[model samples]
Target: TLQPDVFGLVEAARILCEDGFAVFPYTTDDLIVAERLLAAGCKVLMPWCAPIGSALGPINIMALRSMRGYFPGVPLIVDA
Candidate 1:
């Protein structure tokens, strides 16, 4: 399903929010996923700059900057 993966993340975020904990969603530069996480009450975001263990680290600097622009002062970690 086109929405299954997002649904799972949202559900998990909801559960974490319900438990009174902030969520740190790690998006693979997916705006939809990031938006869903935000809607699910995630306070911080950790978007990946590159695939895990890839020689390339942070392939998209603009994307990272854009993500940070969404929420200034919010801790947006760039996980490689």
Candidate 2:
């Protein structure tokens, strides 16, 4: 599994791994990290929407497409 946020995600992944889960945290705000996650057999999970009450749409189509290219079977959910 992969998380967008860095702070809490690392801890969550670490704990999950300790609990025998095959967890991997993708924290770096870099596309290379996404590819690495895929190479390491992680499913990408990104929030392609604004936070809470915000109204913005998908701001990174290229990045999204790149992720899709790497993990087409991995589910993509828009938290709108």
Candidate 3:
């Protein structure tokens, strides 16, 4: 289940676990996958607002907060 996608979600998650952070120049629209990652002790850093080359904002603060709640120790960064 590692390297979940060609974009390297699992690898990025691994690196994040090891390095405390990992950046992937792409987007993941699958919230379930993100939740799974969070459940696996990996922070799901994803965008909830806008799209690539758009303004940054928290489209769903509640969802972000919920994600945070799911992973109390994991850090989720929303980079639009």
How do all models score by TM-score?
Answer: 0.77, 0.50, 0.47
Query: How many backbone clashes are present in model 2?
Result: 0
Clashes of 3: 0
lDDT of 3 by residue, 1-80 (tens): 21136246655565666666544323344456666555444634554444545455556667667666765664556665
Please report the candidate that would top TM-score against the real structure.
1
Model 2: per-residue lDDT, tens digit, 1-80?
Answer: 33366545655655665576765453443456545544444455453444444566655667667766766786655455
**Local lDDT at 45 for model 3:** 56
Against the unseen true structure, what C-alpha lDDT does each candidate score?
0.75, 0.54, 0.53
- Measured by lDDT, the strongest candidate is 1
Model 3, CA-based lDDT: 0.53
- Lowest lDDT sum, 10 consecutive residues, model 1, at 1-10
10 residues in a row with least lDDT, candidate 3: 1-10
